[model samples]
Target: MEAREKRLIFPFSAIVGQEKAKLALLCVAVNPLIGGVLLKGDKGTGKSTLVRALANVLPEIEVVADCSFNCNPMNPLEMCDSCYERYERGESLPIAKRRMRVVDLPLSVTIDRLVGTIDVERFLREGKKALQPGILAEANRGVLYIDEVNLLDDYIADSLLDAAAMGWNTIEREGISFRHPARFILVGSMNPEEGDLRPQILDRFGLCVEVSAPMNPEERIEIVKRVEEFHEDPISFYKKFESEEKKLTEKIVKAKELLPKVEISDDLLKLLAETVINLGIKTNRAEITTIKTAKAIGALNGRRRVSLEDLEKAMELALPHRLRDKPFQKPPQMKPPKPKDDKEHNHDHKHDHKHEHKKEEKSGSARNQGIGSLEQNFRSIEAKIPRIESKNFDGSEFTGYRSSRDVSITVVNFPKGIPVSYVPSKGEIRDVDFYNSAICAVLNDKKPPIKLEMKDIRVRVRKAKAPTLWVLLLDSSGSMAVKRRISIAKGIAEKLVESGYIKKSKMALIVAKGNQAEIFVSPTKNYWEVLEKIESVPTGGRTPLSSALYNLLLLANRERMKDKSVKVRAFLITDGKASVPLFGKRIKDEIIELAKALRKKGIELNIYDTNGKGINPGISYVPILKDIANAKVCKI
Candidate 1:
């Protein structure tokens, strides 16, 4: 059944328009030492299809027969301890040929499942190491594919980084340790619109390619026809590409054989180093990976000498993601204007020259002044706002409507949930942990299934659902700058953020400033970073309240799609004024419609009214906003 499914995969040779992605995969296939490839693009862009199809085109690898670790029989360094012992004893290891596999790392994969777990019972009873192979072990000499890599948990990503860097996985537990070869070509794909990986992990990947749906009409039509044909008759489609696939496989085999012989000139090497330095890439891995990738590319093209073109192509795949600036970064800071002399000002503006220039300079200076003043005001009011005692913010603490009840296996000893899974025991065995003892016993001992024992018992790990995503939309428009209202909004926002942080909730920020609304910060657990970003937002434009709400709706929908059980609570810190109309509709009507839309989506809305009695009177739009949004209104 698995073989048939593998046969039906879309042919790598038949994939359309993702030349860069295909090339990156081929480079890694030719030389796993090139590190790995990260495919970042939108949905339906063939990221997964390309990765799965890559296996069919890869040449067969020789492994020690019956070895769970896929130990390379010829290389003692790549073999497990058991295999190494046999090699040392002058035993001829049985070898088997098999196509390289594409091992998938699921989103819910636990650390134990990723880096092999130990059988405590076997260890204690036999006084020997009994290690179960993990995803990395199974992926040895193969491809490790992680879809939606950007959404991977921090710890899981760290585990991958450590293993990928060392080409080995070490499992240390309770004073016992085991190690195994974990070398593989790591291929990861993600939609950048969802989120981004941390820079440290991103650098671990040797190459990065951004893919998207083909824009050319002809190419798109061709892609559609090819996919439809495959769906109609997968076997026939596989046969059609069999020759091309074989040729590609043969080419990869040749490249791997020739990779060691391929050489780069010293001048070309110097050029590579100089190029990396110019790109401002700090990691030494960039230079090393680029050099290896260049050699692979040369070998793939049946060349022994690395050419300038190979170096250029290698750099093209290697440098883009390594740059300092990443996607969705905050816009650059506004520089203060240079003072203009009266004569120059008069020359530039003939009519009302002095008055116009003075007004222009004052406006720019005032805008800067307003931002400075807002920060200063926030500092003064910050202390007055009560500070809660800092506690470890766990997501499970939040409970309300739309909050997820899905079990989170990430947390241990979750006080109020039923056990859903059994993890490796951490020295403690409870009465309720007998659920998987038999299975553990069978896996630990080579003999027939035995009775459950305390040593074989696993730990019961359970937790509440995923955290609520809080989206804070701050009004940084010109009107809010009046009476230092924007400052008050910032203070309220900071307080809300702090409150959520204490609950271990994820927070996102959207600022309604200038002519548009921007996502200042994506949903993140780093509340302090969000607060810092909020402090720097300048105030000076029409209130794009509708725009802000529209963006909030989009963000909420995206988050919901990523995790269906995610509860989104949006806080609109504004004076309830909508000066900028989205879709050219009435400002009041647009705001009300968007609010209703948000409410219909089951997203909880809250209005933090910054209105006050002063020279600039409040518009009092909060009452209507509250009614339409079904929101809770808080006066600040």
Candidate 2:
């Protein structure tokens, strides 16, 4: 909470390039009627910068002053219990409306935290009245920004899609509750090359824009100049845009007021629908978004008449993710081919064979009636096409027929989803063109194999044995609560256990505190129990780094004797700030001794040191921990 933090970002016009991306976002702002938009691009592409700059121009929100979940009092019907209580008590609840806010959804966030969990303190100490309001509740009627959308752990993304589409936030467990006004514009940004989102989620995005680095030279120069100017004097540069910023704010207000009048004529609507269908998009929602966004663009341009240009702008935003895309996205290319589908493709392929047979079956009288095909006279003509190399094995050269393209037709047919881009309409033609028709007609076709030979071979490589997991040594000292390290520790443990591992590997947890170490959950297949124990551990006590090492030795020794066993590595989850060096021994030597014992037992010790700020400061008692086991740090 710095004083200088609450300030306007650079004006949208001030952004150097990425005009399409900028326009797309602004249209949404003008008419939130357009649902949401995704800014797709790579790192350092100014996606985040452009998004932050949005705060300056987005319309403000009116909220109830004393409402914890910030329910809008003006919409009395939407107020929850707490807000309703104050409303009925006849107390004058102040209303402080503020500019719409952008809430950031960070990765590594736990389900309980992202979606509200019961207030344990109230449930335990006061025996009821659990508190609510997770990130969803707070994001009511605003924007929820998700960075690195592709890499978000799957479960969290599921919840996000649910809340966004349903527009109602509900937590079914612990109690039956409802929060109706939980709708928000979900702005997801990602580098598509990293990975792909589930198709189900991808279809939910109302609009999508692919953002790229500047390709135009003049634009590139402007980018450098604006970025440098902002860097040199961020505050002043922002200040200079204040007037332009205010002007945009006014424009947004005006646009919102003017939005309703914008119309989509039936003719234009049909065009929009045709465009969507031609693009191969799946849902009706895309059409709706395109219409709303087109109108928003018209409103922004100060025109009540929605033009084709406006529709084009909106269509670009709505189709990328929705459309199956060019190059036969429909079945032959659209859906991934299935096993049972091979016959379907073969059925189409057989027409080519049948036409060739018909040509051969012609009566001698028909052949003599001045209607001879060039196929019977191939040797008379000479054509030099690039000779395709043969694909059959040296020993099996006579085994299968090699097609003109050098593809071998084996006894086994290829399965579906494989496209035949070059099939012909006439005469057993595997490929044909108006110009190539005469040429292909002169080529010889191979006679069908009198007796086709076939065989089936299958190899089953057994799945690799599971890697063994060790214990997680967590610091439960009082200071952990102050730094919120305990929460992080528990969260990591949950993730590690949840990190699906094969049956061979096992996980355990050890809580070290006040001169003794206790095993919360033992090494076993029961991961749920381990997770439960981890979440239940209370943080407080002296750090007992020594005892935790001793118990780990016992388990490490037991695991070492097993064949191909992944040595259980203990993740020493600590702040790297331990107290009073264990048992009057030099801390370094103590760490080494523990590590040495582990190594002797064929186990490795790993210390996940969080340097106060979830940043991994490399192995603290390094070379020592290195001796017993490999040590690495992870920050989230």
Which portions of model 2 miss their true places by more than 4 Å? 1-3, 6-11, 76-78, 81-94, 120-127, 172-180, 325-636
**Taking the tens digit of each residue's C-alpha lDDT, what string does model 2 give over 356-386?**
4433543332222321222212111112101
Candidate 1: lDDT over CA atoms?
A: 0.75
Position 102, candidate 2: lDDT: 76
TM-score of 1: 0.64
Off by more than 4 A, model 1? 1-6, 118-129, 173-176, 325-449, 452-459, 462-468, 477-479, 482-636
Q: Which candidate wins on TM-score? A: 1
Per-model CA lDDT versus the true structure: 0.75, 0.60
Q: Least accurate stretch of 10 residues (summed lDDT) in model 2?
A: 381-390
For all predicted structures, in order, the TM-scores are 0.64, 0.51
Candidate 2 structure, TM-score to reference? 0.51
